[model samples]
Target: MKATELRHLLEAALPEAAHAEQSDLQLGHMYLPAGHIKAVALSRPVVVGDRGSGKSFWLKSLVDDTRRQLIGKTFQQEELLSCEVKTGFSPDVDGDYPTPKDLARLVQDGLSPDAIWYAVMVHLIVPESLPGNLVFWKDRISWIQEQSETVTAKLRAKNAELHAKKQCILIAFDGLDRLSPSWRDTVALVRGLLQTQLEFGRYSQLRTKAFIRPDMLASPEVRQFPDASKLLSLAVKLEWEAIDLYGLLWQYLANSSIPSQSAAFRKFADKVAKLSWDEGSNGVFVLTQAVRHDENRQEQLFHQIAGENLGRGKKSGNTWTWLPKHLSDAHGYTSPRSFLVALRFAAVDSNKRKFAGKEFALHTSSLKSGVSEASKVRRHELEENFPWIGDVLKPLKGLGLPARKQDVVIKWKKAETLSSLLAHHEPVPLPEAIKETDPASILAALEQLGLCRLLSDGRIDFPDIVRVDAGMTRKGGIPVR
Candidate 1:
């Protein structure tokens, strides 16, 4: 296919957003990362990921009946096929569980988060024989603790029943970040939920998956409890590599809405990367471990679309390497969401600018523009989760990257950045659960959110992923007016 034809195909091939859409999920188009099979195992209790990672997306997928089975089949986990998945926590409030409002109220009332979560799951498992007047969270938690033997007996019987039929009940928890506004409360809640998961470990068929952010998992407050190490042992990080991102791209391309678009890319994939993605019975393309892990093969596949390098001269960076590097955060992790958004925008730019004269479908300049757009989308995502980011980052817009750490700190002090974060985001949780209000503390929070990089030599640098959209400048970076 010519550059123009391929760009058109790309426009139809890629999804507009990085997050999992119900349409995409129902249509069986999710690119299950092979490397993440272990991280997403039903037995794993704690799932951790950084910002813009697909934690929320997976939370939704696992709770959705159809997609959950699809994940099981893709990962070849037999138990997941017949397993019953329950939503123990999420943004959407269910009648079975307490809302964030209820949890906040209950926490303030001195009810343990462990009791609340365990009660929530117990009610989900066996709703009968519970208090009819347990309309309040405190009352429900009190009931669970008071009737501990009754609840465990009921759970044990249910587990035995399910085990007989080759089924398991996996309670999936997510959105602990929104459990409470206070950092102390969030950690306590997270720790309690994790402790509850530990308590459920005795039963073979009773499992819990608590999807949490890495920072929450790392907090000393959360890991302070006894046997917390067991929960930590069950934890896994949903990290994506350059090749995995490419594999995800191919999954979308192979399952494009337009049949010919799908065929065109899959044909090229087979020809170039020696990749043959089989269409599983579940109506999605499946990738093998060999293709998923083969960096060289994946590079060849990507090079066909965007070419080998950004420039013709030997000194320029390779497009395959440069794309992810530009899209990666300071922690060296590339979110799949940002990855897809960059390519989709690049294709749009390629078509609009008539920049298809190059040998590849996407031109170098257009890819850079793609990174800019992706950065903007990523920042919007961060703002949704942490509203204070825009205010803190706004004053530093036009600041040069890789400057001395003291220099950035001085600017933050003059702008009163820490005070702004406090004064703003009234009910919203502090950015990345920051406890320290000092300028240095605020800067560290920014780094935790993957907004900036602290150099070994006391210099502070911004990764191109965020720097571009944050309006920060770096030497030889993409030009922005």
Candidate 2:
């Protein structure tokens, strides 16, 4: 119960939550909500989500036999294993997918994006069945370029074979944003992929899944396809409900390194929730039955770490809902990555502060400090995904939020940083409606990115996560922490 002892216990019990894109799939601890279960079960061809919402994680899980077996226990979808999954594109350069430069070259050569995807499928399926020289990717590309009809016929034949065997193929395409140099080309490629998926639907044994970002899905170019609405209708958005988030925390704690804490937490969990354990290679723990939103179980568990209130006062605010709400974006979306980042930082902060023995493992101040750190991480992600937005907002730093649009425009017009950033780097996939250097276009770009919102009151509001990182104070000069 001593502060030092608790700190060590906390350290042992809470390993840093791994980002899906960065870490190998943790099959045992994945918390799949009902919506996700439906999405995976239905095998929807298009899964759309915001960045860090576990699209890559889900795709990885689907391809993993051990993970799929574990998932099969809950969903009773053994047919998932019948499908051979392959990555058509991903952020991992070492992955089987072709590089962006290769894709760009193919586009420049006037090769249809759909043909390129089919060639990827051909590369994945029965390479030995084809000519020896065609086995290699470069040869395969050349072959597809020269004999497009032959490649299509081969894929159709393969589909027929799989169909006879009562099996199917799921070719997953992720990291589409990285597939081309410009937004225009990226959209064209994605549209082609979607079209291919639609065309392949008649085969009954060939299925494709595109894990895409929200911004890409919202782009006009992708939506302009004639049957775009049909693909959109089948889209499943990856989201985490309140119960799912709490369930994730529990799952993490149950698998903590500290045996005593893990055992104790499991015992506590057994009393109030249904628990499942994977009997495979990983032997991971999963929460099969989640607690209700109104239940105090989640609160009790977190209270052991973060305490009942953010402070000693009655009005200090409850700790359970505080973390997620504070970490949410402008659209009220919070990814699992952001939540785990905040929790890890809270642990780090608590260890540094050395709270009193009477206090919980994480202090109120430490928790708030975690929010600030998480904001920085989220900001870094934004900068990487949309570098131009970072440049556009640089001049507005130190300004307060909820300011009039005209005032924001005035400040943006006065800032020299925007021009400098634009000179050094062109906006990736310049919007169709606006030039990169246009000031009005920049504001529209910000709004589209969900970094800021144009309020009904004629003011602009930034989400706390963004507002904090941009060094923008609140309207009343309130501090984020």
TM-score of every candidate: 0.90, 0.87
Q: What global local distance difference test value does model 1 have?
A: 0.79
- Candidate 2: segments with Cα more than 4 A from true spot: 1-21, 93-95, 126-129, 135-154, 181-184, 257-260, 268-282, 288-295, 354-357, 416-427, 430-441, 475-481
- Backbone Cα, N, C clashes tallied per candidate: 0, 1
The lDDT values for all models are: 0.79, 0.71
Tens digits of per-residue lDDT for model 2, 307-339? 778767757788888888877876778887777
Best by lDDT: 1
94 in model 2: Cα distance from truth in Å?
5.2
Candidate 1 residue 342 C-alpha distance from true site, Å: 0.6
Question: lDDT tens digits, residues 45-163, model 1?
Answer: 88898765777678777777778777887789878878777888887525367787888899999998888888888888777858788777788788888888988899999889888
The list of candidate 1 runs beyond 4 A from truth reads: 17-27, 92-95, 108-110, 131-139, 181-185, 288-290, 354-359, 422-425, 428-438
Candidate 2 yields a Cα-based lDDT of 0.71
Residue 381, model 2: Cα distance from true site in angstroms: 0.6
